[model samples]
Target: NGQSTNSNEKKLAFQNIPRLPREVTPFASFTNVIELDQRGPLFQGPGAKRDTGRYKVRPTDDDSMKRAKKFSMEQSVKYVLVRQQQHQQRAQLDLIKKQQALLLMCR
Candidate 1:
């Protein structure tokens, strides 16, 4: 029994021994994390270099301006036609409701 106790004490002393600095470095348990930004413009195309200045006004070509004006006018005409169609549909609905009321009164 005394020999067994002495062996147990030796085992505990070995376990409590101070480890070397290299052995205790914890390099295997450490982690390093790096994050990269993914926010800005996806494709910095050729035009980006020329667009550095905020207040620089680029002149619009006459041809493009004319085309834009034509497109705007066409959109306006389309909206006017759609509005007329909506008004006609509402007038037809009101006429149908009035006719329904008159028939109900006669009955």
Candidate 2:
């Protein structure tokens, strides 16, 4: 029983021993499989050498004007469609009322 207790204590001590750092281990190779450039344009401070290869073209005045014109055209089209639908509904209601009046007169 005493020998068994000593073996258990030895096992516990073995388990407590710290392993090597992750960088030194075989698993470390998987950690850096895909190295990404984490620094984006936002993180790059002002006056930092910009990557000329990438064009960061912002919306120009012409582009904004075109967008506004397109938005107004779309809004006008939607308004016309809504007005047409309302006109159709009003016409249908008027026809129903005329039919009801004719039925009452006949009765």
Q: Cα RMSD to native, each candidate?
A: 14.3, 13.4
Q: List runs of model 2 lying over 4 Å from the truth.
A: 1-59
Model 2 TM-score (2 dp) = 0.44
**What do the candidate models score in CA lDDT, each in turn?**
0.88, 0.90
- lDDT, residue 6, model 1: 100
Mind giving the per-residue lDDT tens digits that candidate 2 earns over 32-77?
4677786756566787987779555567966988999999999999
Which residue pairs clash within candidate 1? none
Report the lDDT of model 1 for residue 49: 69
Write down the TM-score of every candidate.
0.44, 0.44
Quickly count the clashes in candidate 1: 0
